[model samples]
Target: MAARERLADDPSITFPGFFDDTAVQTDADGGVVELTGALLRAVEVAADDFLGPQDANTLCVDRHESHRYRVVRRQGIIFIRIDEDPRACGLTVPALHSGAQYAIGSDGRILRRLRDGEPDGSLAPTDAGSGIPVPTSEVGRSFEAPDGAVPLPF
Candidate 1:
């Protein structure tokens, strides 16, 4: 969606002016910024992305030409597990990985690059006091221990 059309979707959402040409930006308080127009189009997307109950496969943000992404939320952090290109998310250099998981402060700044996530979307994320609470999804919540090759408790 065009920026103007996105602006029409939700007029209240304000993207930080820090996004110049690239998405990687540093906030005023020394926080790192990730996920810009390249990853998620804040305007064109609906309010659900911001305030929706994320599931096993949830759309993070649209990038470039409305690329949908599946995300992971753990330890109070959001991780991009998959992209439209089928490349892995949240690992290595952005150029090498095509696109990596995005991190941002609740106040509209980028969170510091902590570490790269695993292939199965295991991010090893930490709790940074961004004030945005990420609840544990039902996807892996049922698994208590492995019953042989089975990954679930049942």
Candidate 2:
């Protein structure tokens, strides 16, 4: 039962070859082959089946060297989320969404077009823990011009 739960949430075990663009094909063996519509449908079906309804919560370890992953299944559709860094570009800025929110299928695939449970933008930036503005230190500038230098008259 645990294995079944992992299969639905873990991308690696859930989808063979992670359903790479040119990974699976039929009508040819041991050689490069063109992807066909039938092959694609097969993969989709495999995913949908493996991700069937599961227990309250499923824990799956990512084999792709990705961050820790968790799944929340509802109505047979699982939402895959990762423990991601909240900062972007390593900048000390507040983003508009939470890092661990994504709409995913029970098959360990993300629903690119779907936005499930909008992220919490209320998260404060790490740099500004208390939401207090931090001021940049101002360095004194050299106001003295070059010795014997004169200003040009316009």
Candidate 3:
């Protein structure tokens, strides 16, 4: 049975429990199980399917008209460096350009936005002006910037 179906059928069965009970066969010697090679790949596939893709870029790409964004995922958050200048393709910091960078959740909600290495005050409100609240725990944490990219100031 598929993992999703198993979870739906049995509310008490966690993902690990489901995997332990059904995903792999135990060794006859001592009932030990090891995840390696094909098994590891299968686990990854199942995880991606169950929890959705880890990268927020796949979720947020459709919202942008340009595909010149660089995505970096760290600690369940996604950082996107948007290249606004058409000539700046493959370049990290466009010269005197007005591109913006964003820290977004895996679910594609904007957490923070930066312009020209500073906080962008012109950010619009979301969810009928209530705006999305930035989680305090997510604030001040340093996310690894993409290669040749400047780190966000948040």
TM-score versus the correct structure, for each prediction: 0.23, 0.22, 0.29
Candidate 3 is scored at a TM of 0.29
Tell me the tens digit of each residue's lDDT in model 1 across 1-154.
Answer: 3222222222222222232334432335878656556234322132223323445565433233223334333344333322333233443324334333343333223332221242423234578767865466754575455567765536
Candidate 2 has a TM-score of 0.22
Ranking by lDDT: 3, 2, 1
* Candidate 1 deviant stretches above 4 angstroms: 1-63, 81-96, 113-154
Q: Where does the lowest 10-residue lDDT sum fall in candidate 1?
A: 3-12
Error of 3 at 138 (Å): 47
**Which is the leading candidate under TM-score?**
3
Give the lowest summed-lDDT range of ten residues in model 2: 59-68
lDDT of 1 at 102: 41
Q: List the global CA lDDT of all models.
A: 0.35, 0.36, 0.42
Candidate 3 C-alpha lDDT tens digits along 8-112: 122221111112223333425778665444333333333333234455564332223323444444565454455443342444553554454555444434445
Among all windows of 10 consecutive residues in model 3, the one with the lowest summed lDDT is: 10-19
Model 2 alpha-carbon drift over 4 Å, by segment: 1-63, 85-98, 106-109, 112-154
What shift in Å separates residue 78 of candidate 3 from its native position after superposition? Answer: 1.0
Question: Which prediction has more favorable TM-score, 1 or 2?
Answer: 1
Name the regions of candidate 3 deviating beyond 4 angstroms: 1-67, 88-95, 117-154
